[model samples]
Target chain A: MIEIEHVSKNFGKKIVLKDVNATVRAGEIFAIIGPSGSGKSTLLRMINLLETPDGGHITLDGTDIRAGPGLTLDIRRKMAMVFQKPAAFDENVYDNIAIGLRMRHVPETEIKKKISDVLEVIGLSGYEKQRAKTLSGGEMQRVALARAMATDPAVLLMDEPTANLDPVATGAIEELVLRINREFGQTVVISTHDMLQGQRLAHRIGVLMNGIFSQVGTPREVFALPKNKDVARFVGIENIFSGRIARISGGVAEIESDGTVINAVTPLPAGTSVCACIKPEDITLHLVDGSQTSARNVLDGRVARMTAFGSVTRLVVECGIPFSVLITWKSAEEMGIAEGKPVKISFKASAVHVVEDTEVRRP
Target chain B: MGYIIDGLREAFHLIVSLDPDVMEITALSLVVSLTATCVATAIALPVGTAVKFTDFPGKKVLINLIQTLYSLPTVIVGLLVFLLITRHGSLGFTGLLFTPQAMILAQTILILPIMTGLTISALSGVDETIRDTIVSLGATRLQFLTSIVREARFAIFAAVAVGFGRAISEVGAAILVGGNIAHRTRVLTTAISLNTSQWEIGTSIALGILLLAIALVVNTGVSLFQQR
Candidate 1:
């Protein structure tokens, strides 16, 4: 387990990280999601002492690394980091994978066996002698992974590991990460801006903003109960409406937005202005009377735009509030949804998430 | 124009014939320069690695000091060493004033800064990722530097070659300190200078051409090593 205390850092006059605290448990994939320049990478670097914190300490396995004696190579052996850009040494593939083991004084025979094993694990068995500079971007990242895993580190810190790869390559890397965690039981703390990737990979996710972790929970918990508007927006909540509460009802609040009353799952005091969020997938598109669906909130509108998003077609229903719904291509065809056609959009009240009232809006 | 062609022909003739005087001077130059370059490299490599790897107060000043030494007048260094090794100077009892060892010592001083500065720049210019990866893999500080130096072997070799080239072509320091004694302390450059002063243009020009050719060969070898 790794525990981060109140770690704060300042670069000259600019504060990179304010009092940030978090804990990463063993054998779980923890993901940190944030926008650019939000100190996510800096926070990850603190775990390995690549970047030291100015204010507080970090502990691994209950030992305070920052306060203890100079962290020898022994301490480094326990944790490894994979950078956003794969930083492989200018050597052949075998040498790159063998370097960490060689540093640990692993014998020549063992080094050879470990390099072969790691290369095989990364699915590059026969590429031992290939120069790292000649490999493609994806292959190079795999080499970086192999090098880190060759030492069998207890913890792996990753910074936007797949942000540079294409979708197929990203998917492959994500699968590899999942396999590594499950097979080896190595704790992983990965930072990324791709919310969808976070949802797919993270057992638990933390949302960081302004050098502060606003919320931390499982993927479902975060999406269902985002602590604030920023997290809701960050988690791909498409239908975020800002309005003042018109009335408080039985376990629900009627919010007035753009001269229309909207119902949210959470109760709020009357006259209080707040933000309400709904996932694009949570909204249902149906070609029927507004009263047919079991959904509580129904709006009638014309189909302002339709786009064929891969694996799902996105329909923008220009109604009281322009609501976007993602449905499969088959469903879009079954409903005969197209641009300029009138349709009814409905969403369950339970799916409507209410967030904090802040001038910093997110959609 | 006639002198130039005649000089070129005589230079080729002396090289082909391996004249005894020419051979002795060439051999002395090779021995002294080789010793100086090896000794200087032995000292400079560690200093360069330290300068690049460690950060301390006055580090930049020390680097600048080395650069300053690189441009120091050879005659001034020659005079300084000459005074130190002279009979009347400090530690002058050993009588090293007019020996080939004195010439080597002077040339080593002249080229130490070249080796150190070039090595420092070469090692420092490598990819930072290489260092990060080595550290991430649990390498000790010393192991990390060793790995870096291994990867930077080509550049370090080039640095040594540069130092050797500078040491071999040096005339002022060797002549002043070694007294340019014949059949013993006279290296290629010293012999060229002495023979030219005596108006022995053919021999002087021949030795100068040979020295230039040797310098080119050394530089070519350095570049080839770098390519690998």
Candidate 2:
């Protein structure tokens, strides 16, 4: 297990990490998600003692890594880090993977066997003799992964490892990382700005904003029920309606604003101002003349704007309140929805998340 | 123009004939420069890498000193070594006043600064990510430095080449310390000077062309290595 206690790092007067405490249990993939400059990379470096946090302690397997200069070397062998870029040595791919093993003075025979195993694991068995610099971006990252894992580190720390690769490479790396986690039982801690990747790979996600971790939980909990407005917006909350609580119906809270009543599943305190949020994909589009749907919230308006995004179309319906709706291209074609066309948008009250408003919750 | 044509003809003839005097001088030049460069590299690489990778007290001063000496005059270095190795000088006990070893010692002084300066530039040119990745892989300090040197191999190669070129081309230091002996210590640069003094244009021009070829080879080899 890796434990960080009250770690704070600073460069000159600018504080990069401020009094952070976190833990990574063995054999779990814990991901840190945040915007740019949120100190996630710096935090990852501290774990390997690369950046050396100006204050606080980082311990790997109950040993303080920053005890002194030589203290980091022995403990760091148990933890290996891969950067956003592969940073492969200008050697052949086989040597690149065998470096950590060679450093540990492993015998030549075992080194060859271990390197071959890692190369096959990362799907680069035939690339052993190729120059590392000649490999593609994705291939280089795979080599970096192989090199780190060749040591059989107890903890593998990655900072945006897939941020530089294409979607196909990203998928491969994600799968390989998952396999490493499952097969080798290596604890993985990765930081990324890609929310989809974070949701897909991470068992638990830590949300960091402005040098502080705002929330740490399962992806479903963090995405569906964010702790605050910042987390909600960062997670791509597209619909935010400013409204005042009007009344509470059974399993529904009605929020009135600008001559429209919005129904939310979660109750809010009465007479309190609140913002209602819903994802664009969550708002369903229906024809103006279609049968009345079972969704709790529906708004009737003309199609204020329509934008096609390859496979899906985004529609902005301007009723008493503006609503953003996502529909498939085939559905949009069937409905004949276009700019200036009339349409009705509907979604369940549960899809409308009452956020940061006491009025939207029950007293 | 007539003298120049005659000189070129005689220079080519001397080169083809494998003149004993000219060959001895060329061989001495190669040996002395190679020795000096090897010694300077032995000291400069670790020192330069340490300077580049770590911050310590008086680092700026040391860097400044190296930069200053990088442009040091060959004659001034000869004068210093002359003063040190002459009788009554500090290291005079070994009687190295007029020997190839003394010449190598002088040239080593001249080349050490260039080697150190170029080494600093080479190691510093290495991408920071290379060092960070090696460190993250749990390499010890010595292993880290070794990896960095390997990553900056081309630059370090250039540094060595420059040092060799500087040492081989130097005339003042070798002439002063080695005394430019007939066959033992007479290098190509000193032979050129002696031939010019004696009006032996054929031998001097031949050795001069040979020296230019060596320098050209060194420069081109370094450039090609860096390109690769």
Candidate 3:
């Protein structure tokens, strides 16, 4: 387990990370998800001691890694990092993969055995004699991964490893990451700006923004219930409305926004100012008014704009304020959905996640 | 034109026959300049690596200063060494003036700046990501430095070749420091100078061809090393 406590870092005057805290559990894939320049890479570098934190401490397996040079090396050797840019030393594949093992003074025979095993794992067997610099980008990245895996580090940290790869290459690297984690159970921490990747691979995801983890939870929790507007938007939550609770009865609360009342399940008291967040996928659209459904909240609106993205169509519905809704292309074709078409949108009260309004808005 | 053709023919004959006098001067030139190049590389690589890795005040300025000295005049180096080893100078006790050792010393000094400056460039040419990978792979400080140096081996070899080319082709330093003493301190460049002054065009042409041939061999060797 790696514990990052209140870590802070700055480059000259620009604060890269600020009072960040997160814990990576053993044998679980923890992913840092954020937009570009959100400090995900900086956080990963700090965990590996590549970039020292200006404040706070990072501990590996309950030992403070920054205590001294001796301890830092010991801690660092237990971890391996693959950077976004694939880099290989100017050497043959076998020697490149053997570098870490040789640094530890592993016997030559054992190093050879490890190299063969790792090459097989990365699907580059029989490439031992090939110069690493001569490989294609994807092949070189695999070699880098193989090089790191040869050491069998307890923690494998990857910072946007597939960021520069094409889609097919990205899939291959993702598969390798999953296989390594499942087969070896090495604690893995990967940072990516691809939210879907974080959702696909990580056991837990940390939503990083403004140099701090705004929310850290299971992928489902973070995707469904982001902590704030920034995270909500980052996680692809498009329907967020500023409102105040008009009344609370039983377990449901009625929130008023833009002259419309929205029913959601929240324990916040009446008159509490909040923002109601909803995922675009959760809201269903019907052409007819009052279509039979068990959903609690229904709003009548007109499609203000329509944009097609591959198989799905995104509709901007202006009920009182704009609410973004996603529907399948076939459904849209069947209903003849178009701009200025009147539509009814319905969603469950539980689907409306409520967070207390923390951001001050200007009039 | 007839005399020039005769000189070329005589030069060809002298090389093909491997005349004892020309061969001795060629061999001494090789020994002195090669030794100077070896000595300069040994000292320059470490100094250059140190400058590349460490952060200190005036580091950029120091690098600029070293680069500016890349064109340092050989005669200026000769004069400087001459004063240092003159009877009343600081290094006079060693009696190195007007000797082969003094020539070697002068050539070493003459090439040190270019070698050191190019060594630094060779090291800097290594990608920063490679350094990160080395450290992340658990390399100790020594191992990291060694790995980086190995990565830059080809460029460093080229730097050494350039230093040798400069050292072997220089005339003023050898003439001033060694006094061009025939069959003793005399080397290729000094011998070429003396032969030209005395109108011994054939001997000068032969020595000039030999110097170019040495440079060609050194460059070819460096290219072959790079290929490997």
Using lDDT, give the best candidate's number.
Answer: 3
Ten contiguous residues minimizing lDDT sum, candidate 1 chain A: A66-75
In order, candidate lDDTs are 0.85, 0.87, 0.92
Q: Write the per-residue lDDT of candidate 1 for residues A1-363, one digit (tens) a residue.
A: 888888888888989788877888999999999888888888887777777788887888988876654754556789888878866676789998888888778899999988888888889999998888788878888898888888888998888989888888788778889999999887899999998888999999988877778888999988788988888878878788888788888878888878767788775678777888888888888785534887888888889988888899988888777888898998888778789988888888888888758683446
- The residue pairs in collision within model 3 are none
Model 3, A69-184: lDDT tens per residue?
87877888999989899888889999999999999999999999999999999899999999899998788889989988988899999999999888888888889999999999
Question: How well does model 3 score by local distance difference test?
Answer: 0.92
lDDT per residue for candidate 2 within A247-316, as digits (tens), equals 8867678988778898997655767687888889888887888988999888888898888865888888
Residue B111, candidate 2: Cα error in Å is 1.4
Which ranges of candidate 1 are over 4 A from the true structure?
A70-72, A166-169, A267-271, A284-295, A299-346, A358-363, B197-201
Candidate 2 residue spans exceeding 4 A from truth: A54-57, A62-64, A67-71, A256-260, A357-363, B92-94, B219-228
User: What's the DockQ of model 3?
Assistant: 0.68
Clashes of each: 0, 7, 0
Clashing pairs in 1: none
DockQ for candidate 1, please give it: 0.56
Q: Which of the CAPRI classes, incorrect, acceptable, medium or high, describes model 2? A: medium
DockQ of 2: 0.77
Q: Compared with the true structure, what per-residue lDDT tens digits does model 2 show for residues B59-125?
A: 9999999999988999899999999999989999989998999998999989898899899998888
